[model samples]
Target: MTTALRILLLDDDPFMLELMTDMLQGMGYENVRAESDARRALAALPEFGPDLLICDLSMPDMDGIEFLRAAAEAHFDGSVVLLSGMDSGILRAAETLAMAQGLSILGACSKPVPRTDLADMLARAWQQREARARPPAHGGVK
Candidate 1:
């Protein structure tokens, strides 16, 4: 919802990847990219320069936490939305761990991801990104 931000969607499930891509396109996002392989997703990260990453936690290639660690090492400052069908507790732990690793963990949600929740998450991430880009203002000294 904020200025055609480049977004990357990574999930081992091809169906989920397609669904999320279509949804993003339907929402008027023109620069959305989907990666079914987590390894490829990592490779694409630098070149894609995405403003956000929506990734699945339980992938065969690389788990979400591992990916988040790599992202952290790579200094990926963009917000991350972790998706999973696992127990809420596990998801919460991943969210907490990702945050501790210094990746902007947005909010973890159970799959199939709720469209409304996804939309809200993206908007919130975009707002934070925009805020970070803006220079702070100061009052004139007397």
Candidate 2:
């Protein structure tokens, strides 16, 4: 079930990105991709068609807020789990902003995120993906 989900991880620090990738792999996700360059990561979204995006909220070229805006504008409907070392209040604000912009935020966590928190976020994202893929229920015409 986990391997079927395509996940894209974005962070400015190459080491952080790699660490995130390893953590994801340890959780049994196979089709995971990590990018240290936010710009390139955004460009890759169309082709990647990821089911879930675990994005860091700060970067040099394009910070996570900009990334969220661009993704929304591009009509990306996939779920997002935002990561940041910023204050909790700031992260919550970003999450709120992302939701207002029509992005599905699965969860947000401060950097050096707890393993259990990340795992829970991934689980929630999977549930969301499954929900989106489900067919709508039928009803009688009005």
Candidate 3:
């Protein structure tokens, strides 16, 4: 079920991008697109129409914060998982900022993320997707 989600991985480091792609593929997520540039990732959003976006916070051209802003402006409604090697406090702050921007933030994690943690996050995201897809419950009035 979760494997059907289209996921976009954005990172400036080519090695990190490849590693993440490999990790996601190993975890049964086949529809994954990796981009080394935030701008290109933003441009690909409309065409890709990913269900989830895994983004690294530290980048040369445009950092993840800026990328999140751009994504919000572009009206991206998918969930976001922020990845960074920065301080935990900084990562938390980014999560807050993303929430404030109306982005459905899945969560944030440090770099070199453990497979277990990644799997857990993905599971939560899948649950959220399922919840969103369900129709609202009706009252007893009917």
lDDT of each: 0.88, 0.89, 0.91
Judging by TM-score against the true structure, name the best candidate: 2
Better of 1 and 2 by TM-score: 2
How many pairs collide in each candidate, listed in order?
A: 0, 0, 0
Clashing pairs in 3: none
Off by over 4 Å in 2: 139-142
Per-prediction TM-score: 0.91, 0.94, 0.92
Ranking by lDDT: 3, 2, 1
Q: Rank the candidates by TM-score, best first.
A: 2, 3, 1
Error of 3 at 67 (Å): 0.3
- Assess candidate 1 and give its TM-score to the true structure: 0.91
Give a tens-digit lDDT track for model 3, residues 25-137: 99999999999999999999999988899999999989999999999999998889999999999999999999999999988999988899889888877877786676777
The candidate that achieves the highest lDDT relative to the unseen native structure: 3
lDDT of 1 at 30: 76
Which scores greater on lDDT, model 1 or model 2? 2
lDDT of 2 by residue, 1-142 (tens): 6778899999989888888888889989989989888788888799999999999998997899999899999888889999998999999999999999999998888888889998888888889889778777674332
Off-target runs (Cα >4 Å) in candidate 3 are: 138-142
Q: Is candidate 2 or candidate 3 better by lDDT?
A: 3
**Which residue runs does candidate 1 get wrong by more than 4 Å?**
1-3, 136-142
